[model samples]
Target: MLSKRRLTGTISNYRFYAQSLATASNSLLGELNDWETDGDLTTKIGKSLAAIITSLDALQHFKAEMKRSPLMPKRRNADAA
Candidate 1:
């Protein structure tokens, strides 16, 4: 079974990756908008990219909320009682 600390670390890694992917996708979508003509294919690709970015953003927000909630274990310092 996975320990709480390991599970927290895994979620943190996932959140980091999701943020990275969302940022990259947003940048790419911006470049595509600036360079590509408004054709059916470009439009479809843009829509897909938008959907991906939205999903990633949502995942990050969910992770943040989970971290703030009481269910996640709080970090402790060695000096604390």
Candidate 2:
């Protein structure tokens, strides 16, 4: 079983990672605006950015669920083996 302190640290790390990714994404958008490019390249960049944001969102959701649920990673039963 994971201790409460360790679980809290893990969740905090996830939150920090998500926030950093969001900030980087915003920076990418700003650079794209400055580039003023159009068509396929722009579409590709937009799609990639969207994918990254979606992944971060999923991580955040997972972290929230972990906090709410009683579930934790199953430990090995040495005696049963």
> Using TM-score as the measure, which candidate wins?
2
lDDT of 2 by residue, 10-81 (tens): 678777767767776776676577675554556657765775787588687766668565556656889999
| Cα lDDT over the full model 2 | 0.68
Model 1, which residues run further than 4 Å from truth?
Answer: 1-39, 78-81
Question: Clash number for every model?
Answer: 0, 0
lDDT for 41 in candidate 1 is 56
Q: Residue by residue across 1-81, what tens digits does model 1's lDDT show? A: 345686677677767767767776776676577665545656666765776777677676666767766666888987986
Total residue pair clashes for candidate 2: 0
All models, RMSD in angstroms: 6.2, 8.8
Question: Each candidate's lDDT (Cα)?
Answer: 0.68, 0.68
